[model samples]
Target: MNSIGDNCTELKKKYDSCFNQWFSERFLKGDTDDSVCAPLFKIYQQCVKDAMKVQHIEFKEIEGDVLGSDKEQKVPPKSGSSSS
Candidate 1:
């Protein structure tokens, strides 16, 4: 898959390749370390951020947890419940 930023595509590809190799060669073997692809990922991430800025998309807006995982769930009150 291509990156959001055209300029970042190469970096993303490099990171993806490294990650895939690491996952299959190291992670699957129980090595568990992922620093091998960190540098490439950082570069790709920065490029995407720059693209987002050029597109007028605020980073903070997309940084929120879309899954609402940290939110407290509220249960509906029972029909038999009475108000004060």
Candidate 2:
């Protein structure tokens, strides 16, 4: 795998290990601040998005369904152009 793949994998692990667990615990504890939580959750979501974006992919998690939409969003390389 390339460096981008490695970074994406690491971030995905962090989201699964830390972010998701924290959100679950917080919501269960009845901390209902949708104002703050929504954006934070979105950031966590964007983290997942970003990590996937790193791997030249996109995904959306809507109402318990994870779907891969047709390549509307493009993931450009962090640097440089691809040689033919």
lDDT (Cα, tens digit) per residue for candidate 1, span 1-84? 888788888888888899999999999999988998898888888999999999899988777565657554666789998989
lDDT score, candidate 1, position 36: 89
lDDT of 2 at 82: 72
lDDT of each: 0.86, 0.54
Q: What is the lDDT of candidate 1?
A: 0.86
Over 4 Å off in model 2, which ranges?
A: 1-4, 33-84
For residue 17, give model 2's deviation from the true position in Å. 1.9
Model 2 Cα lDDT, one tens digit per residue, 1-84: 222354455544554555456568775788654354444445556665666676666454323333465634666676677756
Candidate 1: regions farther than 4 A off: 68-84
Query: Model 1 TM-score?
Result: 0.73
